[model samples]
Target: MDQIIELFRHLINPAWIIDNGGLYLLIAIIFAETGLFVGFFLPGDSLLFLAGFYGNELSASFHDAPFVVLMLLIAVAGVLGNMVGFWFGRKSGPMLYNRKDTFFFKKKHLHQAHDFYEKYGGGAIFFARFLPIIRTFAPIVAGIVGMDRKKFMFFNLIGSFAWVFSMMLAGYFLGKKFPGLKDHLELIVIGLVVVTTFPVLFKLLFGKAKGPIKTEAAKATEESESK
Candidate 1:
């Protein structure tokens, strides 16, 4: 048990991550986190930042335009990861919808999710990439709601590019300019977590004070029922 715990600890440690698997492990984690439901606990934003911080070493084998290569590889992994999530969600969505509502489940919520995705799916996919936990599930939810494949792909590509490049490049440039910056990686990681997490918590806690806004689909359903 102790050995397993310690191994898990090292996996989350950014410095340890860079030292051990370097680029490939980083890529794999990104893929897993974005696609696999089980990867929500893995360190993502901080890992990308640190990968950029250690770009010189990680990118060494590439020789020419190493930073660009590193960013593209990571971005592609992210895109593929989201695609996997979407596939899983799509495969399982019908089962979820067909299942009888229990004490913990309600069909209305599913309809609401469908409506919400129809309206804001694109923006959610784009922005969720920056928010931990949320990013992992957003694509899956998009799949559940039957979001248009072409639309999902368009945003997936753009969002993955934006998220990977922004986080990694920020670290790369900062590390280049300040040689001693990595000394404060712990503080930076904490800040990234807080920044990404707080908004999600706030939205969940307070965004519903006014109650659920009636969506057009809900209204249409109501009208049909009345008829």
Candidate 2:
């Protein structure tokens, strides 16, 4: 357990990440977190933010690679990751989710993603990029549900660019201006996680899930009665 937490922490630390793998690590992590089902354990929001905040620190090492190129690579990784995830979901379908739950594997997230996709459709794909767990699963479900390829690509492209660019840019600019923020990097990551996680937390605590499920179930009952 301690080892797992430490691994996750090391992965989330922007300095450690860039120092070790430089740009490639960032691209790999961004792709895994956004595109792969097993990637839910990875932290995407904080990673992007830290990458942006520590952009100079990262690029300062690469000598040849410009800062903008690094950011673009991260964004592209995020985009491609979703494309990979979409195809995985489309091919695997819901049956892929039947495995038993564990610390790293939870079916609840799949249900939540399903509900979210059902309620919001394409919009979920765009906005999920901002949210945490939801972002990881949204594209997978979108594929499973047979969303039109054209529509999925359009939104996924838009969401990927927006999510990566915005978070990375925010970190870049703020880190440059504040200078002190680097010291609080861990806290900033935590804060970002909390903010990104609030949407799903709200649904779980405030009966949001029950409302949707009950409404749908009731409608089904009514249809049966009418028949």
- Please tell me which predicted candidate would have the highest lDDT against the true structure: 2
What digit string (tens of lDDT, one per residue) describes model 1 on residues 1-227? 57655865776575677667777788899998787766766668888887787788777644534688889998999999999988987877656556685533444434433434555758878877887666777787788756689999999999999999999998889899997967887788778878887875665555443333343455678899999
Q: How far out, in Å, is residue 145 in model 2?
A: 0.5
Candidate 2 wrongly placed segments (more than 4 Å): 204-227
TM-score of each: 0.77, 0.86
lDDT of 1: 0.75
How far is 191's C-alpha from truth in model 2 (Å)?
1.2
lDDT of 2: 0.80
What TM-score, to 2 decimals, does candidate 1 have? 0.77
Cα-based lDDT for every prediction? 0.75, 0.80
C-alpha lDDT of residue 164 in model 1: 95
In candidate 1, which residue ranges exceed 4 Å CA deviation? 1-12, 61-65, 94-119, 204-227
Candidate 2 deviation (Cα RMSD): 4.1
